[model samples]
Target: MRTDIELDESLMREAMTLTGLKTATAVVEAALRALVEQSQRHRALDKLAGIGWQGDLGVLRDPRSSDPE
Candidate 1:
């Protein structure tokens, strides 16, 4: 967790300014968290996309209709 690596100074400064993060570490951590969340959301959307809609909306919306199952 304490590994040191090189990063673009201008990019880091811009990130700090945009995010209002005072330190490089904070900006990096925030970026990592955002990346992880975005990836997870994309994966979830992909999974949902694969499982297409299977039921009729009219039946679902009708209050008097008996249970189809």
Candidate 2:
């Protein structure tokens, strides 16, 4: 898809410099990918935040130890 859109020159220049990306397309694609991945990670964290663990969490401290039955 080809589209023409106006972008902030200063921000673009800074991104190009910091990323060392030679082309606008590459820089934009990398930025978009990072944005999506970050959003996904945050969503996963939010879901995990609602979960509550029950029982002996101390088992996690020493997996080698066994409980007698």
Candidate 3:
């Protein structure tokens, strides 16, 4: 499929320098891959929920930040 869109020049330059990519398509591909990996990692963490953990307690403040009782 073919598409056209505007993108930041700095990102294009950085992508070329870092990935040796001379086109905007390569940068978009790399960014999409990173986003997918991060999403998968988030899913893995979500799957770990309820395995072992305690409920959150009330908020605690720093001793120095509160007046002494």
| C-alpha TM-scores of all predictions | 0.73, 0.72, 0.64
- Estimate, for each residue in 1-69, the C-alpha lDDT of model 3 and write its tens digit: 588889888878988899987778888988889999999999999999889966533424445655688
**Considering TM-score, which of the candidate structures 2 and 3 is the better prediction for this target?**
2
RMSD of every prediction: 4.5, 3.6, 7.9
Superposed model 3: Cα runs more than 4 Å off: 53-69
* Candidate number of the best TM-score: 1
The alpha-carbon deviation from the true structure for residue 2 of candidate 3, after best TM-score superposition, in angstroms, is: 1.2
Query: Which is superior by lDDT, 1 or 3?
Result: 1
| Candidate ranking (lDDT, best to worst) | 1, 2, 3
lDDT of candidate 1 vs native? 0.93
lDDT of 2: 0.89
Among all windows of 10 consecutive residues in model 1, the one with the lowest summed lDDT is: 60-69
Over all chains combined, what TM-score does candidate 2 have?
0.72
Model 2 stretches astray by more than 4 angstroms = 54-69
lDDT of 2 at 45: 96
Using TM-score as the measure, what is the rank order of every candidate, best first? Answer: 1, 2, 3
Task: For model 3, state the Cα shift of residue 26 in Å.
Answer: 1.1
Task: Answer with 1 or 3, whichever has the higher TM-score.
Answer: 1
